[model samples]
Target: MFFIMIIILSITYTDSYANSAHSAIVMDVKTGRILYSKNISAKKPMASTTKIMTALLALEYGDLEAFVKVDKNAVGVEGSSIYLKYDEEVKLKDLVYGLMLRSGNDSAAAIAYHISGSIEEFSNLMNKRAKEIGANNTNFKNPHGLHHKDHYTTAYDLALITRQALLNEDFNKIVRTKRWISEREGYNTFYNKNKTLNQFKGGDGVKTGYTRAAGRCLVTSATRNGMQIISVVLNDPNWFNDCYFLMEEAFREYSPEKVITRNNDIKSFRINNGKVERSYMIAKEDIVIPVKEEEKDKIYIVFECNETYEAPVRKGQKLGKAKIYIGDRLIGTTELFAKENIEKRKLIDIIKNFFSK
Candidate 1:
């Protein structure tokens, strides 16, 4: 009786939470699988979310500890900035902090100049990286996400960029950090502007932006109970409340599930002497899913193997594949292989086996 009541309560909670988001999405950061989404693909200009890529390119290509001279081009660009002076000397690391924490427009230009020799060239690099990452709706015209006719990205694309950024050890470290102070002759402090870091429970560091043209845009990430979700809100009247409610909904609805693990052996079938035998399989890599906790037991796995394999099989040879499916959706797939070599029978043994068959 207790078990039945628990199941009922769980389902009700999932239903209510799943329907509670206004333009929200929950996805596995590694696999890019959408756990839940509402109007996530709608195209919109992403304000300072552009910094994730700017910082990414700088980290990948620019030397962090190298000294950077604030060029004339970087000195007077409008909008928010740390107020860099012309010909001022600052380390690349300090500028990155300014770029991310304060969304410094001058720092963006400095990074752009350092990376591509000019803002025009760096903008090209941004576009190239965006396409490479499968952000189809994104086009970056400026490093600072200033409004341009062509500069736009959707919630889904920002999630993709964030996922890619998280893969880089350096990029992840920078975004997750809430505060930074540069090692200069005098103390230079940069505080992370992501209000979620100070306001929300379990709120990890991320980027936030606002402008008259791009109103109250924010991309937030949080983790709880081993589940991490990234939420993006654009042009919301009440951006903080909307984002908080959306993230809370995702946390309430989705629970982390181990989709594939190195130790979780999968069973498969092999043909030997035209007879089927049970063979075990394992994942080449671990996979995880963000799903409702109650749905964990209902998850189903399918092991799709080759229709047939001739004798003389060797270990680790590619046989076919298997996948886990929940309803009609594919959760994960693993390559199927022979656990051990199965040698063909000797001619005499084959003759005897044929006669027995």
Candidate 2:
């Protein structure tokens, strides 16, 4: 028997997600799967939410715990500020906290200069990271998204960027932080402007932004039962409320289905050579995707592997691959591995006589 196994999973449909924002989206943080969307690809000004990228760049290229003096130009740029003075020394980590928690434009500038030597250069890096994250529609003209005609991102792109940022533990901690006290000379305490952390259950992070031209924008993330989701809204009068609705609806409608468990048996195969007569196959990683609960029966995992193995089966050895399907659509795949080490069977009966039974 050629060991082909199909594991049934579930996924279905739900009503459309509604929101008042001009462009909005909800994405599963783990899989980058969109749970909800409305005009998600429309490019719009990102405002202070731009700081999310600013913070991400710093975490990637700058030393967090190192103390560095603020650049001369970072002081008193525009919009929100941690009021960093020229040549003021602060830890790179604190600047990130200020950038995220306080939505500090000055902190954004300081970080930009500290990391890339100039705002122009830093924006270049931001664009580079956006591309790497698959946010092709996003562009950064300045570290602090004040107002540059070209500085914009689609709701989907922003959500993608936020998803990338959320992967960093440091970034995650900063955005979720409600208040931060820096060692700066004045206005030492910074309170996060993103109210989503306090306004909704399971709300953890992201950022908030507003400018007359951009209306109001918000990016929010929440975690429930080990599943995290990111939501982005651009140019909305009721940003927070819209985000909350998006979050609630997604959580209510979708489920993180663990279609495959890591290091667990997916199928057992008969062996021809050594050790045990049978060997089991498993995936090296878990495939968890968000899907509608009622449609669970529609999702299935198709395991592709050989019916039997010839020789020794090494634990963790790649045996085959599992294709995850939502209905007929192939959603994802993971490589399957041997569950345990099975040494080859030794020549028995006659050998025992030679050894003396």
Candidate 3:
């Protein structure tokens, strides 16, 4: 592999509230870049933030319009609750809304049981989903995140989980909501506990968690100027303020820059044993990188291809790849494809060209 080195200019900022959180991280939602980190990998209880994964699985696998019969186990499971009653019929989507907006432990259990038949099985699914989303340090013991010895996730892992959850439109819609009224008769209106949704500019969907052992844990997301960021803080006394500061820092520091566009012509490669002398290649898709505005100039593109190819090359055939970098870090990559066909030269044509030469 050829190494491409990019030198990005670093920005200077004061760390005034760094000590507020025991573990924390701020990540770019689009690029999955870590903008700020403090003991981000430390294993800690995520409290109700584990509901993010629960909500994610429900949205992905359950039909929103379908009504789930509230199970007996879902009621009175502990922590905050939407006070779902046993055998009450509720829409899956409404339960999700209640789960996220209200931080309802009862809602979480109902979703867990409806989707996977039991809390233990749903916890297993949450763990599987965590690993699938690259949150390796996470383990889920229950969907409500009520506190179990094995129910723990790092700040970085929670950020990773939130990033994945934010990609779902339904998940985004639910978490950003400030208030939701259930259609059920006599049901109390659910209000979001995540204050950042209203308090912070550009703030969107995410979850908040707290327990005596977990302290205050929060995962918040916000979007500004087309760039979205996710911030996670575990066991912070000033969770809201800390997340706000981190988000502002990321938005102020970084901007998304388009590096390449699909089908845009790149450098031509020499073609051997073909009617054409060169093959033009284009990027397979757009590649965007999030970087500091001042450091945008340091973004580099390196194209790697074989010296020559024996063609008949077909249009859109993969030829090589374009690698993008920022300060020695590989940020993105896209395959380079032949823009047009290049048929191999016929034997008779080769003979005639030889004679002419």
Candidate 4:
């Protein structure tokens, strides 16, 4: 029986998943919110999805225009290769195309050696980057996602890494390309093995992977109707089918909602002791949430206020919290602050004002 549930794509995880693989996670790229999660914290062999982090580190540390010499160690290193022979003179850009598009083990090693002088050193960089990106549950033992007893990550962690990668305009451009041809020594070209990049509509890219141990694995991203969703599936017999279905459900059910805008007056409240009787509070910045198209009206916002406050409340002072609710569930929260200041009303001033009255 095929089971499907609609997630509003909100910041909170909705009950919209079924038994599959070891772990799975669907996240909104903008807010870093998990729209759906199942064992997201559980770590497992992520296969080639590890390349997302590899690509990220390479983009940051490895220069794309720099040329790299394919070393002997990078040659004949197991699984999903761009088939690079030893001593190949290829630009880093071409190697990345091979790395991300072809999921080339050869390209991964070439990148590692060129950037860090050795694969072991590059793996160290990968682990450092993983920690910097807030992926505590993840660890990298290699640049290529070839099955390593020690290299592993969770679906949620993969989502976290991809979201960070997408923010790098350069990284996004590389992943979205349909095909890349590299000219070196002679003219060798490699086609992207990511079938979803061409087969599915709005398929931007990401990467695909597999091993005898890490069964059909994939990380997919797409944008439709102004909504972008990222899906990570590991160890599934039908990774593509599951991802497609999940994306369809996400875009079909939800759309982006602007909860508050910067500098916009939120609400007015009375001050106990101040120069101003009432002050209008405005949002410091905009807050947007993803919600079901049908349930847009159900989205609710509540203002929280401090019970008491003294005079001299400075502008931008935290006064309370903004609680966001959707269908009785708390999806997100924002800080509420005083937009302006208030002065103390002294007793002498009050007495003089009363006598004059």
Candidate 5:
């Protein structure tokens, strides 16, 4: 038989990702790892991406089935809208769907007013929530992103906000939906503008935005093989393509590698004045890390704990930590625990232990 040549082309992140956005980032949702970055921390106008926070807060504060009366102030808000009329009563959940799926400025205002009594107060809540989620660089001046001078967020901060929002089951369900019908009398239907939901195989959600000042902005997320990846692109003409490519690159190059398995023996520690001369320490949970394929070889673990533990060790007691590193970069740490109990040695047992030693 003729020989079949097989070439395993090793691809690096630098070669695969060449984004053109003014600011961009790709993060592993589970581990909070930044897979790729290009000016991710630079603050830029986010356009309707601000609705993500608005939707999150609405979900947190408003009862989905409760009726929300649209304030007159919310009726004529600028930019994209769901055409909500003044005094129109709609379910709070439906308004959120309109806000997220339709990028409705009007809906954003209604939800903001319903939840916090005014957009200004709602914005203060937004800033507070942003800080709680570690989106330190983000500042929200309005519920809807309309290019206000004081409103801006970094790609990294937006990703953090999205990550926090994704933790809520209802929020996750709403964003991933492709189409939804409001509970209004006419059954108003709204379609999601996030193109990645149709373009990519596992595309789920996030949001999309555009304005004269912000240009084009998009936040896209996809899940595959038990891993979810989130990507953001700001002020890019080819935002969909950039996000798609970045997500694909992340999936192809990196994977969640378990550095330490839960309850697996990590290292042996000497036990002083105990029935057992030694005790084994193990990880409390799986320490999974997102790492490049080639970078796997560079991964290493360092153990930190007391040289010897005193007797009366209890099972699952905290002993130390295992710090995982990849080429000097600390990826993450896991708590090490005693695998089993080691009771204090009695005088009779001490004599037997000394003789065995």
Candidate 6:
């Protein structure tokens, strides 16, 4: 929860702030699956959520413990900032907290310079990483997500980027943190800017943004019932509430089901010319998938294998494949392996097995 947070808005849209998203999406955090979307691919200026990429680059490339000498060019950056001063030194990690919790544009600048020498260079890194994460619709012109004609991303792209960022343990800790006190200097204490962390159940991360051009843009994430959902709203007047609604809708509609368990016996199949009467097949990977309760009947597992395999079949030998389907969509597939060795049948072997039995 954001025990302390201050709201900053580009325009006061309080009176008619409902369903004002130009683009939006709700994605499953674990699977990179888009559960809901509205104009998800339409690119628009994404105010401060761009800091997600900035913070990510810092976490990946910069040493959090390293001291960053705030560049003169990095000072007094437009929009939200931790108010970095020229030549002031701060820890890379704390800057990230400021970047995420406070939406510090200056913190983003300092980290950029510290990591890539110039904001342009850092923006290149950001674009590179965005592509690596499959954010094909994203193009970053700056680190802070300030309004720029070339600086833009889609709701789908933001969800993909944030999903990858959330995978990092340190990145997870930093964004989810409610409050962080700086040990260095100047406005040392910061509160979260992501108010969804305070207002919504299980809400932890993400960021908030607004610009005269971009309107209200937000990325929010929450975990409920062991399912983590991420919502992105761009140019929304009611960003927080909309994100909450999307996450809640996802939770209500989808729940995880264990479709396959690793090394667990899946089925018994006929074994021809084998000492054993049957051969057991086991799954090699665990597959837990989120599906709607109503679709449970539609979900089915199909096994593809020969009716019988001529032994000797060794333990762990690949036997078949099991595919999971949700209606017509094939969701996942796993190879089936022999659970135990089954030697070729022989008269002497049959007599020995009979005596052992």
Q: All candidates' lDDT scores?
A: 0.73, 0.83, 0.83, 0.77, 0.85, 0.82
Which window of 10 residues has the lowest lDDT sum in candidate 1? 1-10
* Model 3 agreement with the true structure over 9-63: per-residue lDDT tens digits: 2334356536589998887765677787888779998888989999999988999
Index of the highest-lDDT prediction: 5
What TM-score does prediction 3 earn? Answer: 0.82
Residue lDDT tens for model 6, 1-357: 100101111222232224668898887765565677778889899999999889889888989898899999989988788988899989898899999999988898898889999989999999999998888889998899888899999998898889888877798888888899987876889898778778899887888888999999999998876667789999888888888877787787789777777778787899877987786798765666668888788888889897788888999898888877778776656678899999888889778877999
Ranking by TM-score: 2, 3, 5, 6, 1, 4
> In model 6, what are the clashing residue pairs, if there are any?
none
Better of 2 and 3 by TM-score: 2
Residues 1-357, model 4: lDDT tens digits: 000111223344445655365677777665556667667787788888888887888898888888888899999888878877788788888888888988888888888888899878999998888877677788888888888888888887788789888767787788888777787655457677777777777877788888878888888888765456788888878788778777777776678788877677787777766776777666675677668777789989887875467776788887777777777766667777777888888888768777999
After best superposition, candidate 5 residue 157: deviation in angstroms? Answer: 1.3
- Kindly list the per-residue Cα lDDT of model 2 for residues 53-102, writing each as its tens digit: 89998998988888879898998887788889888899998899988988
Error of 6 at 244 (Å): 1.1
Cα lDDT over the full model 2: 0.83
**RMSD, candidate 4, Å:** 7.0
lDDT (10s digit) by residue, model 5, range 16-125: 69978999888877566788888877989999999999999998898999999999999989889899998999999999999899999999999989999998999999
Measured with C-alpha atoms, the lDDT of residue 142 in candidate 2 is: 96
Q: Give the 10-residue window scoring lowest on summed lDDT in candidate 6.
A: 1-10
Q: TM-scores, in order shown? A: 0.76, 0.83, 0.82, 0.73, 0.78, 0.77
* lDDT for each residue of candidate 1 in 1-357, tens digit (9 for 90 to 100): 000000001112344434333355555564556655666777777778788889989988999999998888999889888888888889999988888888998899999988898988998999899888778788888899888877888777787788777667777677777788876545378888888887888787678877777777887777776566677777766776667777787677677777666536666555565333445555555555666776677777666776557777776676766666656656555565566666765678768877999
Q: Which stretches of candidate 4 lie over 4 Å from their true place?
A: 1-16, 259-288, 293-357
Summing lDDT over every window of 10 consecutive residues in candidate 5, give the lowest-scoring window.
1-10
> How many clashes show up per model?
0, 11, 2, 0, 0, 0
Ranking by lDDT: 5, 3, 2, 6, 4, 1
